[model samples]
Target: MNYFITGGTGFIGTHLTSLLHKVHPKAKVYNLDIVKPGTPLPAVKDYKPALREGKEHAATFIYCDVRQPIELEKVNITPDDVIFNFAAVHRTPGHPDSEYFETNIRGAENVCAFAERHGIKKIVFTSSIAPYGAAEELKEETTLPMPNTPYGISKLVAEKIHQNWQASAEDRQLTILRPGVVFGKGENGNFTRLYWSIRGHRFMYPGRKDTIKACIYVKELVRFMLYRLEHHDSGVELYNCCYEPAYTIEQIVEAMKRVTGMNVNVPYMPGWLIMSAAGALGALGSPMGICPARVRKLQISTNICGKKLAASGYHFCYTFEEALADWYKDNNNQCLE
Candidate 1:
């Protein structure tokens, strides 16, 4: 069977594509994304040999935008193929309020429609834990989503769209994974930014050290996704995709220091000071990419729970420290390029 991965050039999509290429070498894998072939994420670049080489297993890149129904209709897909929907405007503060709903909600609608047209029965949707909002207590799959942000609201709505599609047919299978800050090889996100800050000795604890940042390594996350896909065949299933217990910002920094042997000399900065500086920068219209609202997240705890996933017999392949080491190794023994 073939695999259709939307948002395939993205951080998780690229890794998932690579993993599928390795496991199902004979299957035709199509990576549908808004990004063109030549411009891929750094993680995708690492798998170019296996993904773009003149091999049967190499993934085919298709320039497709999920927000448009016409663009999805252009893709040649069969009902037997599995679709992995990873397309969304995920980054907060960077996207306009309407862009989140436009891309995420509309994208979900279009993808579900495409799946219905092709009679595709199986779909895996990667949603965010943002629906849990800024919870200090650990959130689980059963927790009522109290989304406050536009991105979170959009993701929650998108989940319903996928669920609605699955509910239409008894044979259809849908797995919704609400993953926290997923970090690994191609992730030039939070973990990468933290690494640079620490290496440069410019890192500082923003107000609190114990702020929870629920996260999972990209490899482990995809492995779990595959495991769920192989283990479950029908019905709807939802799981919080993260480590059992979330890591504190302090623990994260300490793990990085221990794994990479980076000197930990960061001092705790008052939250008010950081907020004021960020606000001043924003008021002055400075090109400094610091958003006061985003900076505020440094102090907020996103304590998400993954007990349901862990209890489902899916063993974690990497601990926080081990994941960091693996990520470092994957980056060619460097934190960032």
Candidate 2:
């Protein structure tokens, strides 16, 4: 078996590629990324161990932009390969809206076109929970997508793109996964920011402590993807990849305190004040790397139902407390005193 992945150097992609190598020893894995292998990239260091692990086992790396036209002759991509589309310009508070549309929307179209042209039988796309937008309770797969931000809108659009392609190509197998906030050993974005802030003893809580955050560990998400690959007959399935139980803000903070053994202060800033501050920061070119659009997200619940995935025989390995303890133990020295 041979597999081709886009954004293979990314957090989820790296983990998925490593697991694929382990499970399918004779599989030929090809990773296509904007950054060429052996080149300096934003999060390359985080994926070093995974890359080395792949090299020790057997994997190939290719540098190419999925948004652009692919030279199939040069890359040797054939109809026999299974492709995983995980490349996209991830969410950032201050990112230009054009970047999101170009990469997330147009880039996804390019990948779909490539797969369709090559007659790739199976294509797994990594979507996001953001498509369901802010909800008061657990959102299900049948809920209408009310994307609030450009990032969420783009993901929803990409999902539609995949659906259109699959509809046109009856032989193609498409599995779209909408994962919650994924965290692991080398995670970045929200998880990294929160981890660093808590470790630095500078963490602060907003007014309410009841806000729930839906989350999934990276390893568990990868396992689900591999499971989908083995069960290709599942057809065009969409599953929410997250833990069965959700965690509230207070619960997460308590877990952090337990793991760090530090007396971290949780300043209760007024909700209005936080929103005003976030707005001001966003207007001033989005300093602090915070996205103004996500300010509302701080107040809303992010719990999503994963029963559909569980029904597909998927199980989560790490509990919230367990993951936090492991992270703290591994990053004790990086924490601020």
Highest TM-score: give the candidate number.
1
lDDT against the true structure, per candidate, is 0.82, 0.74
Summarize candidate 2's per-residue lDDT along 242-326 as a digit string, tens digits.
7776778778777767766767776677777777887888888665544446666667888888778878876666677776666
Please provide TM-scores, in order, for all candidate models, with all chains considered together. 0.91, 0.86
State candidate 2's TM-score: 0.86
Worst 10 residues of 1 by lDDT: 44-53
In Å, residue 319's CA in model 1 sits off its true spot by: 1.5
What does candidate 1's lDDT look like per residue over 191-280, in tens digits?
777887788776678788999898999999988888988988899999998887888999999888888888668898898887788788
Candidate 1 regions with alpha-carbon error over 4 angstroms:
38-57, 70-76, 283-288
For each of the candidates, give the backbone clash count: 0, 1
